[model samples]
Target chain A: MNAILECKGLTKSYGGKKALSDVNLTIERGRIVGLLGPNGSGKTTLIKLANALLTPTSGEIRIAGMKPGTGTKKIVSYLPERNYLNDWMRVHDIIGLFRDFYGDFRPDKAYDMLKRLNINPNDKLKTMSKGTKEKVQLILVMSREAELYLLDEPIGGVDPAARDYILETIISNYNPEATIIISTHLISDVEKILDHVIFIREGQVVLSSSVDEIREQGKSVDGLFREVFRC
Target chain B: MLGKLLKYELKATGRTFMPIYAAMLIAAAVTKLISALTAGGSEVPEFISAIVYIMILMGMFVMTFVVMIQRFHKNLLSDEGYLMFTLPVEPWQHIVSKLLISVLWNLGSLVAAFLSIVILTFDEIANRALMLDLFAVIAEFLTIFGPTGSLVVLEIFLAGIATTVFGILLIYASIALGHLSNRHRTMASLGAFLGLTAFAQILFACLTLIPNVRVLQHYMDTLQESLQTSIALFHYVMWFTIGFFTLLSAGYFLITNHILKKRLNLE
Candidate 1:
C-alpha cells in the first residue's frame, strides 16, 4: 500500500520550547493506526501539523502527496481534540453545515449512526453531555468519505461503553481504502482494533510496528508500552 | 455558494437580532399608540419631542450593540468558524457575508427607527410636509443629474457602503493579527488597531498633499476646471471613493486570509 501520510524531520516549537522535534513518520492507506503517547508528548501537535492547523518550525509533511492546505483539507476529515462544534447549533444543523461545506460529507451515514446511538437530530450541542458531543463529533468525522481521518483523542473524555461505541462506529463506517489515525494514550482499549501502532515519547517516535508483529514477540502492545515508558 | 454562505450567515446572526428587531417594531407601535392617545388637542408637546429623541437614541444604541456582539461571537468564540473556514469558499466570502449582514441590519434598523420617529412625531412631520417635500427634492435632484449622472450617484452610494464594510473588516483583521502572537493578545489588538488607524491617516495625508506638488497641482487645476458640473464632480468623487475602498478591501482580505491560512493559533 502507498503511504497516505509522510512526515520528514517534522519539528514544531512554541516560543523557545519544542513540541515536536525531528520526528519522521509514514502511514500507509487502509490501516487503523494508533498514535500512543503520554501527556505533553506532542501527539496533538503532530496531528495539528498534519491538518495544517499549525505551520512547522522546520521540516516537511505531505498528506496524499499534497501539502496541507485547502486542497489537503478537502480530503482529510479531522476531529479536533476539543469540542470544535458550535454549542448553539442543533444536531441537524451541524449535519447540514458539514454537508454544505464538504463535498464528501455523507449525511445519510451520519444520520444513521446518530439514530443507532439514540442521538436526537434536533438537540442543541450545548445541552448534550461531553461524551455525547464527542460521539456526535466522531459520527460526523466518520461519515465523511475522506482519504484520511485524523482523530485526536476521540475516546479521551468518554466512558468505556461510549468509547467502545465510538471505536466500533469508526471501524464500521470508515471506507476500507482510507486510513484512520487515532491519537491517544489509552492503549489497552484501542490495542485490539489498531492494526499498527506508533508510540511517541518526548516528541519522537520510539516504536512503529504492527500489532501482530508485537504480539509475535511474546508481548502485548500494552506491556511493551509500559516497558518503554517505565519510570 | 455565496447564496448558501449568506443564508447561513444571516441565520447565525438572526438568532440574536430577530428578537431585537421585534422589540423595535413593538416600541415603534407603542410610541405611535401613546402619542395618538395623548395628542388630544392640535398641538404636540416639547416633552413628547424629547421622549421621541431619547427613544431614537436608544434604538440606535441597541442596533450598534447587536452588530458588535454578533461580529464578536461569529468571528471569535463560536464553532461557526470551524464550519466557516472549512468551506470550499475563500476568506473574502466570509468577510463579505459578515459585511453584508451588518449593512443589511443597519439599514433595516435605520428605516425602522425613522418610521418610529415619524409615528411619534407625526403631527410635526406632516405639518412641515417632510415626507412629501423630501421625495420631491430627491426627484428634482435625480432629474438634474439625468439617468447617467443618477447612476453615478448610485454607484457612489454603493461604494460608501463598501467602504463601511471595509472598515469593519479592518477591525477584525487587526484583532486576528494581534491574536496571532503568543503573548499579550488584547494589548496586541489595541496596538494593531492604533497602528492601522495611524497608517490610514498617513495615507489620507499623503493623498491630500499630492495636489501641493507643482506638476500634480497643475493637472488637478486643469481637471477641476474641465469637470465643473456637479454631475462631473460627483462622478469623480464616486470613482475615487470606489478606488479607495477597493484598495482597503484588498488589504483587509489579504491580511485575514494570511492569518486564517497560516498564523492561526486557537488559544
Candidate 2:
C-alpha cells in the first residue's frame, strides 16, 4: 500500500521543551488512522506539521510524495482542534468561501450535511453553540474532495449524541479512497471507524498496529491505550 | 488571481469605508449649502472657517491613518486572517491586495474630504478662481516636468504609499507571529508593533545619516521646485512614497510568507 503521509524522525520543540521528538509515522492510503495520545502528547503538533501549518524543527515529512507546502495544503483538508471558522460569517458565506478557494469543495455535499444536522444555512456562526460550530467546521472539511483529511480532536467537547453525529457525518462523507487521520483522546468513540492506530506518548510513537491485529491479540484499542499510557 | 484578489480586497475594505465616504459627501454638501447661504450675509466668522478646516483635516487624518490601518489589520490579520491565508493565494497577492486597498481608500478619502472643504469654502475659492487656475497651472507644470521626470515623480509617490501599506502589513505579520506562541497574544502583538516601529525608525534614521541616500531628499527638492511652477507636490511625493512602500512591501511579503509557511497556529 502506498503511504499518503510519511514522517521520518520528526522533531519539534517549543523553546527548550520538546513537543514531538524522533517520531516516525507512515499512514497508507484508504485507511482511517487514529493518532491517540494524552494531553500535550504532540498529536496536534504532528497534524500541524503534516498539514504545513507548522514547520518541523528537524526530520522530514512528506504528504503524498510532496513536501508540506501550499501544494500539499491544497490537497490536505485540515480540521483544527479549535474552531477556525470566523464567527462573523454565516453558514452560507462560509460555504461560498470554501468553494471559492478549494476547487474540489462540494457545496451541495456541505449543504446536505448541514441539513442533516439541522443547521440553518443563513445562521451566523456566532449564534451557534460550540458543538454546532464544530460540526459546521467538520462539514466544511469533509465536504472537500481532498486526498488527506487531518482532523484534530474531531469530536472533542461534544455530547455523546453530537459526537455520534459528527462521527457518522465523517464516515459517510469522506472519499473511500482517501485517508483520514483523526487525533483524539476519545479512543473508544473513534476506535470502531479506525483501521489503524498509533499511540504516542511524550512526543514519541510508543505503538503502531492495525485495529484488527490489536483486537485479535485479545485487547481493545482503549485497553492497549491504557496499558501503553499507564503512568 | 491578483485581479480577483484585489477585487475582493476592495470589496472587503469598501464594506467598512462606504459609510465614511457617504458621510464625507454629506458633510461637504452641508458645508457648501451653509457657505452659500451665509456668503456675504453678515461677514462669516473666522471661527467657522477654522472649524471647517479643522473638521476636514481631522477627517483626512482619521481616514489616512486610523481607518485605513484598522480596516486592513482587521480584515487581513485578525481572526479573519484564517480565511485570508487559506485562500489558495500567494503571500504577495495578499500584501498587494491590502496595499492597493489602502492606496485606493486613502486617495478616495482625500478626494472626498477635499470636496467637502471645497463645498464649505466654495464662495471664497470661486471668488478667487483658485480651482481653475490651479488646474491650468498643474497642466502647464506637468508639461515642463516631461515624461521622464513625471515618471520618476510618479514612481516616488507610489513608493511612499507602498511604504505606508508595507508598514501596515508588517504590523499585521508581527501580530501573526505573536499568535504562534502559547501565551500573551495581545501583548505579543503590541510588542511586535513597538519593535517594528523602533526598527523602522532606526532604519529611517540610518538612511538619513547617509549623505548619498538622496532618493527621498532629491524627490522632495524636485517637489518644492515643481510647486513653484504651479504643479501640486502630490505627484512627486507619491513617486518617492511608492519607492519607500515598495521596500516595505518586500519586507511585509517576506515576513507574512514566513509566518504562513512556518509558524501558523490556527488556535
Candidate 3:
C-alpha cells in the first residue's frame, strides 16, 4: 500500500510515436507528487494509463499492487484535463451521479464547496464559464474520499485567483493517507504544496526527488524546472 | 454497479427521447381531433394536421437513430469517457447499460408510433367492431395450433427482442471499431457498419446455399404432414432465428467491450 502506484517498464505509443517508453516509477502514498513536465512530455499519458483510460503498449502499471481495473478505479479519483461534464446536466445532478457511482464521493462536502465558490447547484453545466466548470470539476474530485487523487492539470486552465482557491480546496480536503498527483507545467504555482516532484521530458523521467532535496542543493523547484526543461 | 450505470444512462437519454415521444403523441391527438371536427367537410385541415403528424413521426425516427449513435459516441468515446471509463463499474457494464437503454428507447418509439396510429384510426362505433374483429382473427389463428400456438406467440416476441438487441449492438460494435482509427472516426464508423452488414448478409447467403435449402424443403414438407411435426418444425425455425440473433448480439457486445477496454483514446 505504501507504493500507491508502481509502473514497471511501462510503454505506451501512438501510431509510430512513443508517448512513454520503458518507464519505471513508483509513487508512494501520503504525498503530493508533482508530475512536472512541459507540453507533450508524457505526463498526461502516464496519468491516463494509471486511470485505465488507455492501455499500455507494453509492460505494466499497477495501482496498490493491482492492475488498472474496476478495483483500482474504486480508490482512484480523477479530474481530467478536459471538460468531461455533459452540457445537459446541472451541478446537482452531476453530484448525484458521482455519489451514485463512487462510494467514496461525499455529496455534502461537494455541496459545501459549491456554496463556498458561489456556484449554484441548479445551474446547467453549459451555462457556466470555462473557469467555473473547471472549478466545479475540481470540487467533485476533491470531495471524493479516495485513496489516490489524479488531478491532470487541475489549475492549468484557471485564473491565478481561482488557482489559489483550487489549491486551497485540494490541500484542505484530502486526508493524510491519500496521495495527490498534480500534473502541470505551472510548476511555480503548485511548488509550495508539492512534497516531491517527478520531472519528465520527451516521454522520459529525468528526475524523481523530494522538495527538500532540491532545496538542500540551493535550487527552487521552479528554477530547477526552468533549467531542466529549458528550450 | 450496472444498475447504477443504467439509472444514469436512462436519466441522460430520457431528456431527449421523452420530449419526442410526447410531441409525437400530441401531434397524433391533434390529427384525430381535426379529422373529427372536419368529418365530411373540407379535407384541407385534416390533410394539414396529418402532415404535421407525419412530420413529428419523422422527427421521432430520426432522433431515435441520432440519439443511439450520439449517446455512445459523445458519452463514451469523447471527453466524457474520462468520467465514464473511470467509474468503478466494469467496462462490460457500461456496454450493457447503454445497450439496454438504447433497446428500451427503440421499443418505446415503436410503441408510441403504434399508439399514435391507433389514436388516428380509432372511432367509437366503427373501429370498435374492427378492433374486436382483428382480435378474433388473431385468436382463431392461434387456436388452430392448439397448445403450441401460445408458444409460437412467445417465440415471436423473443425474436423481436433479440433483433432489437442485435441491431443496437451492431452500431455499438461499429462505433468501437471506428474509434481504433487515427482520424475521421464518424466516417470510419459508417464504413464499419456497412462492412458488418455486408458480412452478415454474405454469411447468411452462404448458410442458405448450404444445408438451409434442405432445411427449408423439410420445413415445407412438415407443414403438409401431422400437427406435431409442423409444431416441432415451427419451434425449430423460431428458436434458430432467436438463437442466431442472440449469438450475433453477443459477438458484437464482446467486440465493443474489448475495444473500449483496450484501445480507447478519447480526445
TM-score of each: 0.88, 0.81, 0.96
Off by over 4 Å in 2: B31-87, B122-130, B137-162, B169-252, B262-267
Please, what are the lDDT tens digits per residue for candidate 2 over residues B1-267?
687777766765676577766766666666566656676775465446556656755766576676555654565555565456556677667766776777787778777777766776767786777778887897876676565456655665656566656766776667766766667877887887788777877876665457435655665667656544433344544543465556766775677667755666544
The CAPRI category of model 1 is acceptable
Top candidate on DockQ is 3
How many clashes does each candidate structure show, in the order listed? 0, 19, 0
lDDT of 2 by residue, A75-181 (tens): 88888787667555789988887887788899999999889889999999989998888888889999999999989898997889889988988888777899999
Per-residue alpha-carbon lDDT of candidate 1 for residues A1-231, written as tens digits (9 for 90 to 100): 558999999998888888999998999999999999899999999988887667788999999988877788788898988777776799999899889878999899999999989999999998999889989988988889998999999889998888888888888888789999999988898988899999998999998999899989999999999999997
- Model 3: which residue pairs collide? none
Docking class of 2: acceptable
RMSD of each: 3.6, 5.0, 1.8
lDDT of 1 by residue, B85-120 (tens): 555665556666776777777666677667766766
Q: Would you list the rank order by lDDT, best first?
A: 3, 1, 2
Candidate 3: segments with Cα more than 4 A from true spot: B124-127, B219-233
lDDT of each: 0.78, 0.76, 0.90
Instruction: For residues A51-132, write the lDDT of model 3, one tens digit per residue.
Output: 9888789999999999999999999999999999999999999999999988999999999999998999999999999999
